[model samples]
Target: MRVDVHAHYFPADYLDLLTAHGSRHTDIARIPCAGDAEGDIDARLRMMDTAGVDLQILSAAPQMPYLEDAGNAVEAARFVNDRYAELVAAHPGRFAALAAAPLPHTDEAVKETVRALDDLGFAGAAVSTTVLGRTLGDPSFEAYWAALDDRSAPVFVHAAGRDLDSPQIADHGLTWIVGAPFEDAVGVLHLLRAGVPTRYPRIKFVVPHLGGGLSFLLQRIDDNYLHYHEAFPALPSTLLRRMWFDTVGAHAPALREAIDSFGADRIVLGSDYPYFQGDLYTRAVRYVSEADLPAEQVRAVLEDNVRAVFDRL
Candidate 1:
């Protein structure tokens, strides 16, 4: 079964919450397809069919609610997860989901994570590379990490578009173009330095956009680890390999870099959907099938790696 693990679908109501609390850079959350009587699910399904994707595991990222109020966060999270669950129920095999947690509020986020996974039967949960200003490695997220580890949930890490605190990426519209992958790289590296992966071994973390060029830089990091041994209990490359990644950009050379960095068994197909609609979406799925990699590796990235990353999927 071909699964587009990194697909996204924004509910209209949820979009409203994003605007109400914060702009969430609504421009990024905007779906290219025109809205319909059925919320355009039919249009999306047709698009998926054309792309040869059997299923799409939808996620709400970059626009995730990283609210300050736990109460408001819970409400927003429930609304998003409920909407996602409704889509999965409406169309069985055609779609699956990764739940959105109202994060930066640890306890509430943990409760929502459990609800999204255990009650809603979501494959896993999606989080931003940084929640508000706190990196995934922040001390406040320890309970959140432990809870997910206990359930062996696959955590999808996406870049929080508007929340990137870096002044360098702020100007010249770099937020979407350069900020996405850069945040992924910085975010995961923070966790590696914090030893979150080693601390919570069962948590299956999935970084997006070819782990934001980490494949090409792992050796450099491993070499530098000797000077920073006090920060990490394990090698940076070793912990990163334990995480999973997706083929969103579908750059052949970079995918090969990721495979060399961490075998294809740790990679999976991700269309990024609406952003790469039509021909681009088709290419996202087709690239793996037609890559220069070995046949066994191709099958693993297209199918087997998904099962390995999310046992519940």
Candidate 2:
């Protein structure tokens, strides 16, 4: 079965948190929240079928309700996660989810992660590249990471905002175009510098946008890190191989590089739905076949890799 690990959907009620907390990013009016209602989800299912995606794992990314207020964060996590549980129960194989955890509040995040994975049966937890500028490997998130690592949970990682904390990119209208992949690269480098992958070896970190050009930058990252931190456990490039990257970008050279750098085992299917609708959405899936990979590796990217990364699914 083909599984897309990088699809997105936002629950309608959860969007209320945007106004309630004064969300800094995400244009509310333009959100493709068609999956909020059951009727809209039927449409999503039809699109998935048309795109040859047997299952689309949903996540509320770039708009994840990471409110600073613990109470609001907990509330937001509950409602959104509960809704995902509902859809998963209702649809069975057609949909799965990476539950939202209230972050920047470590203990609360831990509780929600436990509940979501241990109780709710989500495939994993969703987190942004940074939690209000706090790196995923920041000391504050150690407990939360520990909990996820202990549970052997897969964490779906993405850039939090479209422009991704940049002024130049936003002004140039290259926000989603250049910003997303740029943030992906920065996020991976941050985690590598902080040793998140080696420290939490059991935690499966699923990243998007062909790892934001990490495959190309691996040598530079290794050289820079080894120059100063030669005593670190291992090269950043070596540790990075442990993580999984989704095949979201259709660039064949990048896809081939990812396969060569990380191996076919770590490349998973990702449609990035709604954002790339109709034919563009289908291309997100079809690109793998067009990349001219072996039939076995193509099947691995489409089906086997995701299941291996999010084994709970």
Candidate 3:
């Protein structure tokens, strides 16, 4: 069973709410959302069939509005979670959703997360990499982290946007291309330095985009820790291994490096589906197949690891 863990779908009601209320990110208005399988059932199923994907662990587009009024954000989150529940109920085996939450609004976000898991039957919760300049490692989220850890829930950390105010890469479309992955890297680094994995050992985190260059940066991070131990304490290699990564990097070399760094059991298949970067669903599978990995390792990447991560589904 090939499970694509990183697919995206934006509910129409959520879109309408964002559009009507004036989106914080202007680019959202220009994007084609409803046309994609945000709420459509047949279209997504057909694409999954074509891609040889048995199931898609769906999530809202990472560009969820975190800056909206708390009340509006909570309402939007409920609408999306309800829609996800409806979809999962309709197609029990074909799809499972990662519930959206109104993050940065600590109390509301925590409440929505519990509701999404307890009542909505979602696989887990999906959150942006940063919440209003606060990374996931920020101390303010202790309660939220404790809740997830207590439930042993899997949290999918997606890149929403990057520091656009920075003068460099300000004009180009680098925000989506470069900034997105950079945010993922920064988030992972913050989580590592803040000792989140060690602190919340039971909380399973699924970091996107080949762990935001984590596989490659592990040496640098650890080497730097030796010099800056006081500033950022060192983390054990085992703790780092506890985090899961998705197979979004289509290139053979990159995927090979990820497998070497993270091991196959820690990596799951991901096609940033319906997004331009997700166009390589079949090709990603093929890349892993042709990488000369053991047959079992490939199976782990495509299916087993996902089931293990989102076991509640």
Candidate 4:
């Protein structure tokens, strides 16, 4: 019911820990949506009200724990996941959650996935495109993938901030502008190449930023696949149908392309709330409602699709 599926919220303790740990590699205060009391339920509710969102599936922002030390990452993950569980418990219908896990720490990530799903009752797990420079398609993550597949859990793949050190994209804030979307596209394409959708068909994956320009890039991927049929068992289009995308950063044209490519049932509402990209929340929700699509399609993207994807919650 009017679910904003791509909202982010960090717990107080987790923020403190992140502030204390230099290994996270960035200052929390520097985060765009940071410094706001994200864990404050009243503030969250007020923002949701203003945005006309009935519910929000809270997730960790890109500040997700992806450090080198497994122990530190695991501890941070527990703190984050526990805080998410607490929020979900404190406000039942207003908020749901996707558990945070220590990516790059394969075994611990798997364990946290189990606890988050089986014990914490989170709708899914939130993960980044790359884990400490390693793409999601890395062999090290097979067990982790298998675990999520076993439960058919939804995995929301969000883009971490771009790699600013790259020579080509270091200028004009391209890291946030171009690199973020680029990383998402690359990571997703890697998964497609690895046949992850075919191998672990049960895991329900959700990609943000309207599949991160994937609608526009699918043709290129298909062209490559056509040239090397032996390398690909199936086209990205085939596997993409098995996944879902959220309507963040997708305006009329992009959203239309996504619907044409991935269909309405595979799309859901996502506001990227409280991080307002020029009144992102209200404008995004309004955009869908006012789009040229039929009312049924709007309903599917705004409400029904989310219910279907995260049905357990």
Candidate 5:
């Protein structure tokens, strides 16, 4: 029941293919976690065991989409998903896979999503906040959202790596400081503001890194929405609390704030395993358990919330 919903793995062939292609655009190649040591499934599972995680939901790194060319991205997505399915087949209970799809290529992404879900038995699909710099709410991605809604699949909105042109890359390194969480927040905020959820209510979305700083900024976002309703008629009146988050980078204060704002049912356990911040999961959980949160709420965040989200899959 101790499910780590945000773990990652890439098959050897896929890794080799990425390397052989000399695809240097992705930060994964530059990031330590996406390197060879943590890229293997067995090593990731071993780390999970050490962290007291009983189940790890394996997902492809968001960098996989940097292939950019829709055709190439689709082919690579198929390979990655097929390999992910093979891994799940190899280890029934120990592992489950959240398949990847080639986004921006809505038709191909949808096709791959159905194949992965129906034939591959994948738990769900993983997509970065944006596709080639375009957020999921873009008109180009409506078809992809429609397909996910049709299947009622859970989509993991992971943060993309640092933008190659960003100034932060000059100051702080991509993996160490900003890349991941920044993209995560951007994706979540985009979807919330773009009316994706309102349009397709069945598509369950999970944002990691304690909602990627969203929890900390909820009041500001909500206040802005309230204040700008006249100017921004398209903004949804519902509170941002409708979105779900994971306790990945959250500490005690963050966790308490998220639970207080979003409630426990919407927060699940997430371990960005093998990443530099992997320990955040254990630390956050310990803090919650020790801080005198209701036993039932703590259990829900650690176990039930994940089951509720993934049970359909």
Candidate 6:
């Protein structure tokens, strides 16, 4: 059961909505969204086949159209989740979907999350690191976190519109040079420091792109904590071992380091399919296979861990 846990899909109607209403945080003009409905599914499946992926779990692109009002956010989430459910029902074994919820609007997000799980039969939910320009650790989101923890569903935190106005974005382009990984790292650090895992232990988080440079930056974060314990003492776990990572963009050495830091069971296979970085599944898997990890460990990451996290499907 070769499962690619981290993959994205954009239904046409959703993209149309985004295009109709301009995004506040992200430059939707740059991000290529699926304009046609059937083409998106066809392209995704073709890429999965080319990459030798047996199953691809589809998640909404994290930079969901921003809802100016909280009420609209709720309605938008319902619409997105319904579309995702339709996709999963139409294509049974070939694909599964993670529900999209209206975030920064906790009540609505939680309500939609329950519907996605109970009625739509989605495996889990996908949330961006931040909602309405606020990080996941915001006090308003405690209820949302609690609900996800109660359900024991995994949340896929994708790199979305964070620090869009940062100096890096001005200097370099958006794809993989800096913005994506930087946003992911910042989100992970914020979640850990905000005591998310400590507060909601059962709510598992899967960070994509090899945890977005977290494996290399753990020591730096710990060093800063050592120096400034009084100021920033809320380091949730001991190290990067608590969270799960995906081998989407990690190379051989990086993957080995992630295994050493987080262990094999904490790692899973992910491919940012239908994106320019989509080929990472074939490329990174081949690289990691050459590292001579035991076959069982490979299988656990490539298949079993996904099943464990996405058991609802």
Would you list the rank order by lDDT, best first? 1, 2, 4, 3, 6, 5
The runs of at least 3 residues in candidate 4 whose Cα sits more than 4 Å from the true structure, single-residue gaps closed, are 24-40
Candidate 3: Cα lDDT at 232 = 51
What digit string (tens of lDDT, one per residue) describes model 2 on residues 223-300?
A: 977787654468877887889999988888889999999889989998777787778888999989999899999889
Query: Which of the two candidates, 3 or 5, achieves a greater lDDT against the reference?
Result: 3
Query: What does candidate 4's lDDT look like per residue over 223-259, in tens digits?
Result: 8788877455587688787789998885888998999
Top candidate, metric lDDT = 1
- Report residue 10 deviation for candidate 5 (angstroms): 2.4
Candidate lDDT values, in order: 0.84, 0.83, 0.75, 0.80, 0.72, 0.73
- Stretches of model 2 off by over 4 angstroms after superposition: 28-33, 162-164, 230-232
Worst 10-residue lDDT window, candidate 3:
28-37
Measured by TM-score, the strongest candidate is 1
Tell me the tens digit of each residue's lDDT in model 3 across 1-313. Answer: 7888888776656777776666666344234432334534576676677778888888875656565589888877888788778877878788888878787787888899899888777788888878777887888787788778888999898886765345465577677677777778777777777877777778889988888778888777777777667345445345568889988867778877888887878998887776632245567666777877888988888778887888886
Tell me how far candidate 3 lies from the true structure as C-alpha RMSD in angstroms.
2.4
Better of 2 and 6 by TM-score: 2
| Candidate 3: Cα lDDT at 206 | 93
> Which has the better TM-score: candidate 1, or candidate 2?
1
TM-score of each: 0.95, 0.95, 0.91, 0.92, 0.88, 0.89
Error of 4 at 261 (Å): 1.2
RMSD of 5: 3.0
**What lDDT does candidate 6 reach at residue 11?**
60
Looking at model 1, how many pairs of residues clash?
0
Clashing pairs in 5: none
